[model samples]
Target: MSFSVNKTIAQINERIRKGKAVVLNAEEMTEAVKRMGKEKAAREVDVVTTGTFSPMCSSGMLFNTGQPGPQTIKTAKVWLNNVPAYAGIAAVDAYLGATEPSEDDPLNKVYPGQFKYGGGHVIEDLLAGRSINLKAQAYGTDCYPSKLQERVVSLADLPYAQLLNPRNCYQNYNAAINTTKRIIYTYMGPLKPNMQNVNYATAGKLSPLLNDPLFRTIGLGTKIFLGGGVGWVLGAGTQHVAKPQRTERGLPLSAAGTLMLKGDMKGMNSRYIRGLSFLGYGCTIAVGVAIPIPILNEEIAWFTGVDDSDILMPVKDYGRDYPNCDFKTIQHLNFADLKSGEVEIMGNKVPSVPLTSYAMSLECANTLKSWIEKGDFLLTEAQEAIPAG
Candidate 1:
């Protein structure tokens, strides 16, 4: 009878031991699960929580309860546990078909991959204050040319020819002015003339001539004289030899009696004819005097004047207006009406919680999976029973 009683007592003791072991294991498992939950919470909070997006908890929690409510530790604990489970299920559902093994199959026996959280937030921040070089992209070129040169030619016969014959000047001056303006406007920014389209070389050659001091100084009458008969005479006169005269009397001698004229005679005649004879013989003579007029310099000065007086002043005034135009001046402005604490999220003001929550969840899940594979925590009975374990 005593042996029987001893045997029965031993059986009861064994069952108690097993039960104790099971309870201890269950508690450890719960603690591990809770640790994972806390980690996930922290990650999600880090990723999704922004100063702008933080749920204004005037009551000391996420939701708005104006009274400064009491702390409920139990409620928080419950929330922590539930969030992970809910997140896992939601993730599984969201990535239903995309997973290698279906969501319904089983939890992954293998550990998680690397954590990939906060990427979405990083991307959002990058996009917020970004700028781009639009001119470089659009024009496939650099900045505008700051230096430019233009020539204004005052033709001798333009006005008179247009008045009298009209047909002599085939090119319309008005049309030419308009076209030149268009060219100036078109090439106002950085532009390269298409040599293939026109005689860019001719334009280049004319540019230097336009900048010449003599060209700018020459008047209409001077240009007419230089370009017309006078020019022809001067060119032809370089080779002309004056015929020497021979006379019986003490007068101008005949050709046979007189000495040969060594220097250019008709050239001197042409210069005299053109009213530039005072500028000595064989001197470098430019008929139509050009003067360099700095068009770009004048334009830049004008632009600078406008900027200093108008643009900069107005811009500065606009900036100052922000500080001067305070709400205090308005009679209806009331401080009490402005409820300071977390205002209701609505309309366009409602913040888009960047996909940080989802990303962090993925990271947490991956971390948990890694811990489990690394044997950081013991598995369930069913999991332990698997062949790989």
Candidate 2:
């Protein structure tokens, strides 16, 4: 007799609660699938977790501060530690963008100004329990008399603080190179001229979206590990292209899918959420995100079995092509080739490095796996699947 495996997320959760669900990280699942085949592996494995740590430029936070005084002042302008925030929301609510620079910083006044601090750093400082300088300007009115507010505030002082990122955890991204004579600074870090260096951002095989390329198990309302805390997928992210150029193995060659994520700042860890600034580039935040894949059948198992060699990245010239909105690719490379430290481009050998940290990605996967094995975390069924183009 033969049995086909098809497990529901609820069943997996029950097994997890009973301390019997077989959970593995993406790396382990790959090896298991190799040894036992997809059929057998799918039946044995309950869940496979995935992770990625990369600079998500389109990420930020939302906070609501209580009425500073007795008057109900509507904030026209808001600044947190010299960094401007969008205060067009409610009375005292504001949204801080990660890429927003501090007003005090002389940006571009000097060539390639070092954006040492910005919104990302503000978020980090708040999470670290440091005091923040809050200043807001408002036009005084009859009902709301207060015009200006300034004071020191900590994370706990705020009524609500949420990490509401518009986009994070990209499915797959580009390998950036500079074809110009001079070095160029970008979010991918500085790229040497003449394609001397190649920089790509992704956890490759360990990436959450790559392990489930088709969004089978990941979607809106799916529970995830975000910034070292439990978060939920809000929806498909901005600039999300559900369908894009792909290889024979069905891996996207460009930035195909992205995620809109939200989590509570109170429950987050500072280590997983970091502030980063590239030399010539502006400010951004490095967010740690992970997703758990529940193995429902052989196909899901096969998806999780993808190796680094199977995931391909498109190499685009940041010098001109990318800046001009040209999606033209000079070549395609696999993580296996990138991890080797160097790859050949146009018959010339160039050094390759990952902008995302593989060690942190591994740690995220292991941490999520442990949460499941210890019955602290349960897999969630996506209420609605992500949109497919």
Which number leads on TM-score?
Answer: 2
lDDT of prediction 2: 0.89
- Per-residue lDDT for 112-216 in model 1, tens only? 321111111111111232221110001111332112211221212112111000011000000000111122211111111221011000011011111111122
What TM-score would you give candidate 2 relative to the actual structure?
Answer: 0.96
Q: Distance (Å) between predicted and true CA of 357, model 1?
A: 2.7
**Against the hidden reference, what TM-scores do the models get?**
0.11, 0.96
Q: What is the C-alpha lDDT of each candidate?
A: 0.16, 0.89
Q: Which ten residues in a row are the worst by lDDT in model 2?
A: 105-114
Please write out the lDDT profile of model 2 over residues 1-389, one tens digit for every residue.
23388888999999999999999999999899899999999999999999988899899989987786866788889999999999999778999999998888765556547677789989988888899999988898887678888889999999999999998888889999999999999999999998899999999889998888888889988999988899999889998988887666567888899999999999898889898888889899989888999999888899999999998888999998999988798888888999999998889899998899999999888888899899999888898999655
Give candidate 1 misplaced runs (Cα > 4 Å): 1-352, 379-389
Clash count in backbone of candidate 2: 0
